[model samples]
Target: MRSRYLVLSVSAFLCFITLCNKSNAQVKLANLFTDDMVLQQQDNVPIWGWDKAGSYIAVSTTWDKKIYHTVTDASGRFMVKIATPVAGGPFKVTVSDGKPLTLNDVLIGEVWVCAGQSNMEIPMKGYKSQPILNSNEAILNSSNPNIRLFTVPRGSKTTLQQDVKQSHWLAASPESVAKFSATGYYFGRLLSKMLNVPIGLISCNYAGSSIQAWMDPETLKAFPEIKTPAPADSIKEVSRTPTTLYNAMLQPIIGFGIKGTIWYQGESNYDNPAQYDSLFVTFVKILRTKWGMGDFPFYYAQIAPYDYAQLPPYNKGGKYNSAFLRDVQRLDEDKIPNTGMAVLMDIGEQATIHPPRKQQAGERLAYLALGKTYNFKGFGYQSPAYDSFTAKGNSAVIKFKNAANGLTSFLKEINTFEIAGPDKHFYPAKAQITGGSVTVTSDMVKEPVAVRYAFKDFVVGDLFGTDGLPVSSFRTDDWDYNVQ
Candidate 1:
């Protein structure tokens, strides 16, 4: 009798093990494909998951009730590209491999990745002791089912991760918007209103992350000095560590369909400004290649004006000034294709690194998208960048490229202009509006070889385009800050 019972128990245990193995092979999708997710519209967007190797699966979209088929690869990963319709959906997408898994409330619309450091991570509710200008009002009025939000939680690892652990897409409501990225929310809000379509904004950011942190190993290989974190190393700053953020945070969501990415980073990389110029281009190129998307609209914010040297002891100056970093960001626009930058020269705060006015930053990015990406005409989106300067004598007349409406100081005295001779010593210069250009001259510095506008650790920009957008901090000379 005991032997018979033992045999029966063994048989049942083996059956249970078989059942568990079957369960392990169940179809599983990336966390980004959760309910309420949005895919890019009018494109072949990817829908992927894992199942038994060699298993065939069928994906059905409710928008058209069409079935797309694919076979899982040797690694148990299956991916199928489906053609999405124009921006409008609260449809269902179902995947089946014997058993069916369905995602509800799926949207097909403009999807944007909103990424960066603390400024981008700051929520609509505002951070403690620091507030986004008119955040409360924005949050209270931020209810719209047309907008969707998702945030990738903070993580860092040495190896590439497959998917996020705890994440879901939430429809924009007062409750959800309060925790969502302020810049992302504002940007999406404007897009939804202007385009009158569903808008999805993914907040993928870590506070105080360096540019190297977002770069992949292949992209950073050229820079030998930047090293990845090892298992044995004790990490003090997880976000600042190279490649770890890309491994854990960015890697998991690489192929997700995105219209483009809007970034507001570079504060942490301010100490090394020159390298950021080329690194930014390499990062953007590799990212587009990985996504298999054509050069998409890649708009980013020029780091806001702040007293970066005033973080602690306030002794930092010269080479550590963040103006160089902003300049590199400006130069990146020329290096990369389909790129734009929202200059924040007017909104910087001297007391805090987090600027209170994120709405302007977000809206500026939207204007770039509407004008450049969507080809919406009229109204200025590009800031008036310094174009060419002609030095006839002591006075140098600087021409701007996008100042079609001409430049203005709003009747305020412009005191930030500086003129420098070949010796590299810059002196305060009197700037006068010369029709569409600005002519500057300094009594102290004759025969100026270069000109700088609002070029300092922290300066409230007084110069602006007639469209109300401020000119980015600029310097014509490539000399290092300590060259003098």
Candidate 2:
């Protein structure tokens, strides 16, 4: 009797183990493929996931009614490139691995990746004491079904991750939009209304993260100084460890198709302005390579003016020229192809790092994407930039590109102009608009060798393009800050 009982119990246990194994053998999709997701229109969008080893997986789209097939590798990974239709979708995508899994309410539209630090992460509700311009009204009006939002979970990892742990697509409503990235939401909203199509914005941001935090390990190898451990700070709380955020955040969704990325970073990298241009350019290159897209549109916002002079003593005396970082950002646009910058010379706050006029910044970024990427007609996307400067007897006459429609000055007199002599001592100068250019003269510097406009830690410029875009901050000289 005892032996019979023992044999029966052992048989039942083995049967239970078999059932569990069978249940766990189903296929899984990437986190980005949840319901209400948006795929880039008119591109080869990649659908990838994991399944039982050696299993055959098939994907079918309701729009085309065509099935694409691939087999899982020995390690259980499967990927297939499927062509997406143009600019419209309320479609369904079904993937089968012996069982069917369907994603409904999917969209095919223009998709943008919105990335950066605190400024980009700031929501419609704003942060701390800095409020977004007209946030209450924007939130109340945020009931758009055509716009989709996704926020990646925050984490830091020592190694690269294949997938996000948890994420979901949320449609824009008052409740959802209030917590969403205001800059990203406004940018997408503008694109949707102008293009008359769906828009997808993937908000991937980590506040107070340096550029190194978003770069892959291979990219960080090129900048050995960034790899070294930062000196300890007891008061400040954030981590400056290299490649942690990239491993945790960026790697997971790299191959997901995106029209481009609009960035609002650089505040954390302000202390080390010297390496910003090369680092930023290399970061863009690495992303393009990983995404398998060659030179797609890369639009970014210049760091808004902030009084970093008030940064704590532990921050290396806290005396940094944030203007230098802004200059580097503009230099990136000149050096990198298919790149543009949104100037924020008039939108920043003097006492706060977070700027309230994120709406304008977001709209300007959208203008770049709309005019340059989609070729929208009559869109004056490029801001006025310093084109040519010739020294006269005691003044410099500067010409500008993208000022053909003419310029506008807010105040009675144009401000923030500076002139420097051979000694490199910059002093305030008188500036006046003449036709499509500005003439600057300084009584302090008689033989002015260089000109700088809005080149301070905090400044508000009056010069604007006829299209209503602010002129970019600029410095004509390459002199180091400590040269004098």
Candidate 3:
């Protein structure tokens, strides 16, 4: 009996040793650690992967050449932090437990996660329905190896994934730029030219995705109105389903260090525009927490003017619901720190939702990042926003911020100003720009209690700052203006 027990114990020990050998032989790195990738500079970026439990892994970067080490946990997951140099690299990252896995042609530079709906997902090659403006010229000039691109595969899973199914980082060329996000590519190219550093863009966007679809489930639970149907057992269209894209596309790259994020979405959430203030604030908070990056720059484009109300041709008669959605996005500037909105009111088309002038939108976003986050001086990134109003007897004096250089009318006359009294019936108000403030008065309104500018679904308002940025739509009241 004792001899039989010894033989059984030896067999069990051998099996355990075999299992250990299998685990050790299969050291794998996260898919994010790929060739032609970019890492955030001047930060301790995490280099992580799987190895045998209790096995020590060594990590080194070609830029620094200092070796760092860490051991795998009981779950066979290992992560090591490596310091990156300043914004410049065509370096390599090497990790080893028993065998070395190397990521080559890596860049250490500014990396921004460009994420949102179809507007952001639109490629430079132009959509089947909407052709991008100046795309041919842009594509021809886009053969820069320093500008890298990585587009997250569009799909959804109910559960969070440690790695994306399949993806690759490609150096920007005419062919690659045609397939990548137009806004993302333009933004990166601008940064690369201005900052003189390699720019890496992680395009993690999907068409027709709502803000709820990109938010965490736990965060959405607090706002029941904004949350979608709960994640199910099987995968569906994650872009449309709440929390699915966050689980699949964003969750895998949550810890991957990035400089900031630029978003272009809101059409999908226009139905619940009122709740967007809270939902968007909550979304930014959740993203900051998940990324463990404190208040990183978050810039977004205001929803462009679209005929969502299906107004008749040559008709500006609509509920102006999309205008309200733009207002909600603007409110984030006051509610959250390190946030900005790119006003695309003038660039949008009345007939189509996808505007052709995407370069202007992208350049506007880059300007915000440069001026606000990177401390670029003398850079005009903001438009003249409505600051305050003073009722002066018959007329209301509307002051504006960012109008230090004064405001100008692109048209022969200033347009889209409406004034109302206690009864709240707005009528066209004659507006005249005097210095930095506009004096608005109407023969119809005796005592103007409220003022609105460009507060319609589609309006070609001529108000602009001397810097040439258009004025965003604004109203000084919180009235429930939904006409649905």
Candidate 4:
């Protein structure tokens, strides 16, 4: 009887160990494929995860009615490529590893990732209450079944995440669009109208997030000269440096092909505008390299004007009236290979940080993508950028590169010009267009050495080219400020 009991106990222990091994060996899909997920169309959609070594895996989609199979590598990683359906779906994906794991209610559509700072995260409902609100009527009628949205909840960490805690795709309707990102909703709507295809927007933006938070740690560490040091306490808490929000939000979706990226940030990095030129180029280079797509359309909105204070001494940090950020953006045109900037100096509000004019912002971004990426003819994509400036006595003559059909003023008068002598003391100046160049002079300064256009935190300038695109803010001086 004792021998029989011993044999039974050993057998039970062996069975339990076997079951545990099998459970650990099985392949599991990421949380992104759970239910009501949207996959990018017209591309090879990748579904990957971890499993036991040498295990066979199979994935089947109902919308396309296709099945794909693969085997786990030595490291237990397995990837299967499946062609996406033309239209959106409420379909299912079934995965088999001896046992079955099914993902229900998926969609195949135009998947776009909307990223930026506070302005991009500002919802439509917030804009509805503002003075310059313009999209209330459009929001009321925004019930499109072909459009879907998935918002990544805001989180901060110094580690890469295999999956987001909570995020699910919802069909875009009047109620949904109102709560989603206003700029993202408008951009998606325009794309849907143009292509006549279903659109999916993945909004993963955080207000007050720095550009560094969206960059990989390795990339950031590789260029320590460019990296801003974090708080000492935060550094010592963890042996491994904290991965940025971009790693958590963007890394998981890297292999997933996206049409393009629409960005509207730069406010947080305004304090150190000098290094922004190099930082912006580095960020774009790494993003393109990681995505495996060379020079895809990357469009961004220039920082709009807003009042820092109502008093004088605006040149202290140079923060109040610095064109440094815009200058860095302008430099990107020459440095970065394929990129576009939508100038918004004309549309910004003087009092509000969150601008209410998102319709024009999104529309302009779409216009650039349409012209540059989709090959839309007769559409103007470039804005007025600084070409060259020459000093002519007490006045400076400035030339622009994208002065399409010549330059014009939005108010039909010259405004928002400032000239400074060798002392760097700037005074409000008057400007007038002469042929393709604008000559600026100020009565207060006898010998004007430098000229600045739209250099205030908030300027009432209407300077634009004949094409109606606003001229970018610029400064001819390399003066350093306390803000640095």
Candidate 5:
């Protein structure tokens, strides 16, 4: 009886071992390759997965009917780049390496990475009572097969994840658009209308996330003050913890083909506004490097004005004004190439941090991509940016760029302008729009050493180009001030 029992136990053990081997040999694709997905059109888009070690993997697309082959490495990781055709598909893709896998409703078109904090993550249905403008109307008209959307679930980890959890792609419909990012959805809607191609927007964002949270440990080597999270450590604020989101959320989706990225964040990083300039540029550089994409268009929205001091656990620090944060983002455009900023000067709400004008924000970002990136003509898409200032006696004339048809105050008085002398004390100035420049003069300042426009924590800007895009808040002086 004992011999018979031992033989039975050995047989059970052998069966378990065989099951494990079978599971390990099955081919698996990355999380981004599921149904209703869009790949960048006419590019060698990467599709990666794990399979049996050293096995030959073949991937074929219905549109091209071309089979791309590559061999798996020793670790069982396989990656193959398949050439996609131009912007049209309701296609099928299949992969095999002894074990078969398939993805349906695949699309070949423009793809964009939409990321940032709460503003970008806020859905079309909006938050509670704080509603997005004409959201219901937009949602009712959102049944389009050409628009594809994917929302990456929020995750924070000490180690890199190969795939996203609880995530999949869905085509645009009333139900899906209502839950999708308001900014991302609007941006996609505009692209689909203009380019007349399928648009894919991958929404990966976390609420109240700081800039540091999206940065990897290696990318943040220049800053020693930030500590890396250990696996065993208890992290209470996962969104605020550096390198956590980068590991779990961003690292997995790297190397996916994309036309560009659109960002809307910085409210969380307002307290450390000065360091954000460095952090922003570094993050963009690292993302560009990791993706192997050469300087793709990086467009972002300047966080709109809000009373920062009114929020809970708020710092009364006078220098914590949000304008500094906006300026840092504005300056980063010149520091990095192929980048643009959407100014929200006229769309802010002084009381609520989450501005209700998200559609405007989204459409503005689309304008940048349309004009600068897609090279659409016969439309003024850029805001009038402060270029240079020349002093003539008591008045200072500020010239602007992107004002080919000239600047306009639209019959409204430019009350947001201020002039300062060497003392750094600012006084409200009278502004006159002359051609592409604005001449400012204050009776108090005999010699204007500096000029600022809409530079307050919560002020509306009236200056604009003939295209109606408002000028961004700016300051000529770097002198620090306490706005108490």
Candidate 6:
């Protein structure tokens, strides 16, 4: 009986040991630090994860053969820093405790995290009206071994996630770039060309994601008015809050530094133009603060024209108009230091949400970064913007900045213009240019109370500066849409 009891006790102890081992296995690091990872170049790379308590961790890379080491805290969290490399390569990282885990095919290159709405998320393959042949040729013939891509799976959570479910890095090829963001690819291509370095693009964008969805929950709590819940009680409700995208997509990769950010957003927030000025400023502040990147170059695209709701009051129903949103964007450019706006007021599709002209958009953003940040000369970084306006009887004369030599109409003839009176009645007006100023007049309004250009959702305006860049929408009135 004593021998049988000893045998039972031994079996029980073995079973308990196996259960403990299984639990520890479940508490592993995130997938982001797996094999074939590409750390950002010229930045402090953060390698972190969960492990057994008090477990000593060591990391090694080709850039520094001297293995960096750290020990897991009480919470099973560990972090180690590694210097960035200018060029990319096939590297390796090994972590050890009792057993060794080796991550292979690691690369050191430039990594950019792309985030925003559907336009930024639009894949190259399904873009309508784009020349499929051109994209196909570019993809198939791609030989840039240094260019790599890692796509963060789309997800929304009220709480921050330690790691994404699954992800892997892929070398840019025809098959890969086809499904990648066109804007991101073009931007990466330009950077790779100019810098002559390896580039890694990290895409963490969602279709139709609002500014509110990208913000932090605490940030949203600060603005009670914006915290409205979606019917399903999902994270989508968080979209109404500012900086929601930053909380989700950006927060995870905050310390994973890159060259800079190229933004293509703002369509979703156009309806609430009044709040955008403050919200945009707040967003920039949050990103810069969280990332510890002091006022790095943030280049964004101005919202392009789209079809307006053709109701009695055209600007209602959360629809987008040009001047209001563009003004908000301009405010960011003027107020935010080390920031640039890529004006695409002339390149947008009138009827489509996802404009197929992504190459131009990407190039324009690259132009700003090269000229302003990289100190490249001879690059036109800005499009002409309305500087000031003067009233002359029934007409208003408008002057512009960044006109280069002078302003010219891209249209065969001058097109989009409107004039309003004290009664707030607006009518189509004719426009003519002299030097860098545009003169707007209409026969119906003998005395103009205000003047507006490209105020509607879609305008056939073709005005451009001497540099051939489009003129952004402008307005001189502040009348409420419903009151009008």
Query: Pairing residues by index, what is the TM-score of model 3?
Result: 0.91
In model 3, which regions exceed 4 Å deviation?
1-24, 226-237, 311-320, 482-484
Task: Write down the worst ten-residue block by lDDT for model 5.
Answer: 1-10
For residues 12-116, write the lDDT of model 1, one tens digit per residue. Answer: 434434443444456888788989998999998888889888766667788976666667889888888888999887999987665678999998899999998
> Please, what are the lDDT tens digits per residue for candidate 3 over residues 1-484?
3211111233443444444454436578887778999888899888778877887666667786566666688988987777888988789887766467888999989999999999999999988968999999989988998899999998677766778768889999999999999988888889999998888899998898988888777888897665455445654555777888887888888888889999998888776676777888888888998889899999989988877767333323333467888888877778888988888878878888889899989999999999999999885899888899889998999999988889988656876899888778888889999878999999998888889888887666578888888889888767667421
Best-matching candidate per lDDT: 5
Please give, for residues 365-422, the per-residue lDDT of candidate 5 as tens digits. 9999999999999998889899998999999999999899999989988999999988
Ranking by lDDT: 5, 1, 2, 3, 4, 6
10 residues in a row with least lDDT, candidate 2? 1-10
Clash pairs for candidate 2: none
Off by over 4 Å in 5: 1-24
lDDT of 6 by residue, 175-280 (tens): 8888888778888888889977677887778777777777776666766777644334555344443444554566776766576787888877777787777777
Clashes of 4: 3
Name the candidate, 4 or 5, with the larger lDDT value. 5
Model 4 agreement with the true structure over 55-130: per-residue lDDT tens digits: 7666767775555666778877777777776765777887766566887767676777778887777877764456
Task: Give the better candidate number (5 or 6) by TM-score.
Answer: 5
Judged by whole-model lDDT over C-alpha atoms, candidate 5 comes out at 0.87
lDDT of each: 0.86, 0.83, 0.82, 0.72, 0.87, 0.71
User: In model 6, which regions exceed 4 Å deviation?
Assistant: 1-29, 34-36, 127-134, 228-248, 308-323, 421-423, 445-449, 482-484
Q: How high is the lDDT of residue 87 in model 2?
A: 83
True-vs-predicted CA distance for residue 233, candidate 3, Å? 4.1
